[model samples]
Target: MAKIAYILLCHKDPEAVIEQAERLTATGDCMAIHFDGRASASAFRKIRTALTDNPNVTFAKRRVKCGWGEWSLVRATLNTLQAAVEDFPRATHFYMLSGDCMAIKTADYARSFLDQQDKDFIESFDFFDSNWIKTGMKEDRLIYRHFFNERTQKRRFYAAYGAQKRLGLTRKIPADLQVQIGSQWWCLRRRTVEAILDMTRKRRDVMRFFASTWIPDETFFQTLVRHLIREEEIECRTLTFLMFSDYGMPVVFHNDHYDLLLSQDFLFARKISPDAKSLKTRLGRLYAAHDVTFQISNEGRNLFQFLSERGRTGQRFAPRFWETESSLGRERELLIVASKKWHVAKRLLAAIGAQTDIPTIEYLFDEENTPLPDLGGIQRTLEKRTRHRRALMRMLFDYYETDRLVVCMDPAALDLMHDFFSDRSHTRLLRIDCDFSDSYLIGHARRVGLAGERAPQATLEQLLPTIRNDIANEVDQIRGAGFSHHWAVQERASEEENARAISNFLDLSHETALDIVRAPHLFAD
Candidate 1:
């Protein structure tokens, strides 16, 4: 009786979309599809043919000419979600996905898991964090008015190049609604998906504002969902894995990533190619979400046994797939202690990973138990959840004896370690300065007594100015207490400039230092 409604927005590969849709539909799913208006009619017919046998699949009538960085992308997804909800009232969960993604988990486990959970699964981050602006949060996305069909799909529009010529914001962002941004692909409870559709209808102005804005698809649902649902009630994580190249483009899944895919418990992995069709057909059903699937290929049997022997604990304890600095001759020096602001740390780490002098570093991030960062290559993480943030940081500082110790952490973690690392040689603290909105952070603090990293003592009125002062005070205290080297960088600066500063401070050579200044992430592939 359980049903999951899938809303898929794809511009290419009708056949592939049909194949996966059938797999999902087989698992008691009602499907809603939206092919890009720009797609050929033949492609549309092919998709319809693929789903003709299944009465559960519905196609959106208001198809969108989906273009990258355009509002139409958001429109297509909304139409698809609305169609799915309207068509299948019994479905409790709705998954928003791309055509390229294929399911790694079985339908029964997915349904069972949703039945047992109370949280709405969606990936979101602190939008108020000014540090993220450089990570592709363009200023125009909020202030300026964007008109539809501004450019044709055949030619790539260079908005960043026309930064000076681009339209500026006509009005200030609303005071009440706190903005949040994250991965566009997610699985949400039916209520959450319905809430998104309802908000678009009732909050026309909000939708209007994002309509012309570039790539609203990434933020529209995320910002609206946070408004309708409680932050804790929302899972703020996605189950799909998309790999990016060193230049940040998605490539088709190849044999090289077999271990990487099998290690993690992601339900779907994307950019699958036609060449891999045989491989998928051979061993597709064995990957389950909550438990191991018995099905496997002969090559995978031994690899599965090897991972099982390592005490694998479901998705959270997947075998890490990255190259550690120790693999080379680099010594342990950089220690990045991050929290929910781990996204910012990922950008910094990406730049560091490119350097020849990269330290045997650790991006230690098990604090909130959020999804680990995908740094475009093989990613590995030591997942250790710490009950005490202040204590774990101190233990890590002394535990590693390196010539230069670098730390990127929250204010609370920094405050606790102020005196501890004061006199240590070659110790550097890269303080992450951020500004949170009033409603979410301040309002939640009043209800829960502001106990985490920020100054729990200051009331809401004093919080606005006091929070920044606290970061400065903490930095000053850490310096006076005894750290050898220290630098404070703004999160709002261009990601490249931020990386450049860190690269210079870390004493990387000037020639390739600019390499550290990478471009921000565009819309998800």
Candidate 2:
């Protein structure tokens, strides 16, 4: 049987967009189509590169601007379907996705589900059921699906869908049948897709009618499906699973409210930062053999980090074409961050250069720029000491820029990294944890005689036993008035200490002070 065609609609953030495409293609059954509408050539290049080495990826030549309430999306969607139909004629389903949204299922599972005779996956939300009269409709929108082509035929239909409890229209369609305000992103079976496309081709009036509806995306397919069901035309149900919310809001520093939302049973959610740990931890529970993986684009930074980390350093830098406020050129920043440094402050500069340029500033400790101290064995210690601080730096920049960063190295930084970036409404101070990883920055030592080739790993293994002891001794020193600055480790010593640790972490990390907001539970434990 022909497999489901994975149709990814990527607009920006070419790296993460195509990275997700790569992930989805790994399933081996999905074919990916990439379209660039007013996106940078670099963005297009990334999509092109992603699909180049792959056999299943196809690039669409038609470029259309996707505006809210415009016909562009419809045209694009139809064009992609036509291409998929031509390329993979036997394909049975079309899975549409946004560039930023990750794949939540393997192709095998997707094929299995799509192969099922009685299933159609669409997001469902109630509409006009309450306070419908206020909208001024005279008939149910569902009833008008047939006569939707005729303007005069819509009055009674509006009354049915628009009338509230006061209008004697108390009838409740099956929540499934009730106006299923579906997501623009969805998986449509062949029959459903073909029906919609056929109607588009056969009826100009249908298109014109939808062109005038509010939120045309939700109305277009919905009208057809409602009409189909009413006429006993199809077997499909709207899924009421998963609600979405932004997770990298700056206020997240004040409180990790997004973390709470990740704990719920949501089949899918979008716009999560790759580095968000608390949210990752909460959402990781829902991960299965089939689930989409996503990484947010750092407003406009981190592409170099992604390239370098993915070992694409030799790849040519293609500048994306766009109007920018930066006179030096929008592409200059990419070149700046990708260069190697020869000094300590320059090293710091190298890091800053890698950061997205949204109000980003560099803070250095040198006054005269003297030779930096290599404090015997202290450089290694300091790198460990700076983990949380560095994480905070990344979190701050990512939040301010509203872009995602592709971490270059060290999984040691994952959890702390994520916690620092989880979306919040206000910035809050949070303490950095130095003990998240057992390994030290022995890179310099490893290269020199001070540490052996296996020394770093050996030190990591030996350091495990000392972690608690060393941190405890440090805590004791602080508690006894030897030091007053607030400090806390990831591992808490007691109930009070744990709470205090959490409080301190929040206090030092949050850039602002505000009540934490909560999101619906989407990830199941």
* Best TM-score among the predictions, by candidate number: 1
Judge candidate 2 against the unseen true structure and give its global Cα lDDT, from 0 to 1: 0.42
Q: After superposition, how far is residue 342 of candidate 1 from its true place, in Å?
A: 46
Write candidate 1's Cα lDDT for 228-274 as tens digits: 89878888777676654332334345445555565555667775654
TM-score of 1: 0.52
RMSD of each: 19.4, 23.5
lDDT of each: 0.58, 0.42
Range of the 10 consecutive residues with the lowest summed lDDT in candidate 2: 332-341
Q: What TM-score would each prediction reach against the true structure? A: 0.52, 0.42
lDDT per residue as tens, model 2, 1-525: 436776776666676666565665665655656564745566687678766887667756577655433445666777777677667666677777664343333344445545554445654344554332232233444332222222212233344444544455343333333454556666666777777777778777666655544445665665566655433433333321232212222211102424333333232345454434555444333333545443333222243335333443445343211111102111111111111111222332222222212122222111123222222221234343243343333333333332322212122223332333332322222222332233333433343354577655767565555554654454343345322223432322433443454334233223211111111110111
Q: How high a TM-score does candidate 2 get?
A: 0.42
